[model samples]
Target: MAGGAIAVAAVGVGWLLWPSPSGRTLPPARARVYTEFSACLLSDSSGVSGKAAAPVWAGMQEASATTAGKVSFLAVAGPESESNARLYLNALVARRCDLILAAGTAEVAAVRARAPALGSTTFVVVGTGSSAGNLTVLPVAPPAGVSAAIRDVVVAASERTSPH
Candidate 1:
């Protein structure tokens, strides 16, 4: 099965990257190279506040390491107004993030309004919402759905779906 192959590959990679006597893991014979993709998260002014936001960001961070991509976050500096969130979303878009993750309610609303125009960028709402061309929502029911969506995006990035 594919899972068995992946498990073997992971163990092989671990062996190749085993720690040295100096405590630093050694590089593999040929390092796997990935594209310069970036996944950015948009949250409220106080950073991650809600329960789902932290886990969502953690998933993104873990994916970033696998894909050699960049993971960054921007918290709306003021109130959680849709307008304020729009400004921060604009900043992330300008940075050419391959995927923009909307965490807070205001951020998700702003993303919904703006995602139509930014059709080239994929926007993923970490909670429940509707889907557009480049925008999709992940339900917050079972925690695994969120993790699976995050994993899906990592595979997407690895497949060169990034708008980089």
Candidate 2:
């Protein structure tokens, strides 16, 4: 794994549900459990299928597996605009996502715009984005490096929010 970076914005700052051998897994489907921390994604209209977003999503799933965390995503609706992006971001915020991931240019921009006021809910912009306040930006890592880059972010968030 190579080519990874984590920058704090403004000089600051899952998918499967399967029980691991040590019980640190979230089942992909049936019989889900509260993972204590949830990381949600705000992707472009292309959603998970987009090339840029897929690796990030995969990294997120890897993190979920390691942290026993929950992962979910919402694809932005058509007509890419900040206003529309905000709606999706608001929905994720409303869901009380412990960490909100913004992948894709549009999604990252939306996160940057709203992150300052959101407070406490960590924002991760995975790609070419600027880090500020509560937002953290990660490089568009290569396929081999996604897991390592994402593992740190997700695990840290999980530990910070987890009660047990």
Which lDDT tens digits does candidate 1 get at residues 76-141? 888778999999999999999888998888998999999999988888886665676988877775
Q: Provide the TM-score for each candidate, comma-separated.
A: 0.72, 0.76
lDDT of 2 by residue, 1-164 (tens): 12233333323331133345675645477665657799998999898888767877888888887878999999998878888899899999999999998877777888988999998799988767578788998887686576577778888889889987
Error of 2 at 99 (Å): 0.1
The per-prediction CA RMSD against the true structure, in angstroms, equals 13.9, 19.0
**The CA-based lDDT of model 2 is what?**
0.82
In terms of TM-score, which candidate is strongest?
Answer: 2
Residue 67 in model 2: shift from native, Å?
1.7
- What are the runs in model 2 whose C-alpha is more than 4 Å off? 1-30
Which residue pairs show backbone clashes in model 1? none
Model 1: weakest 10-residue lDDT segment is 155-164
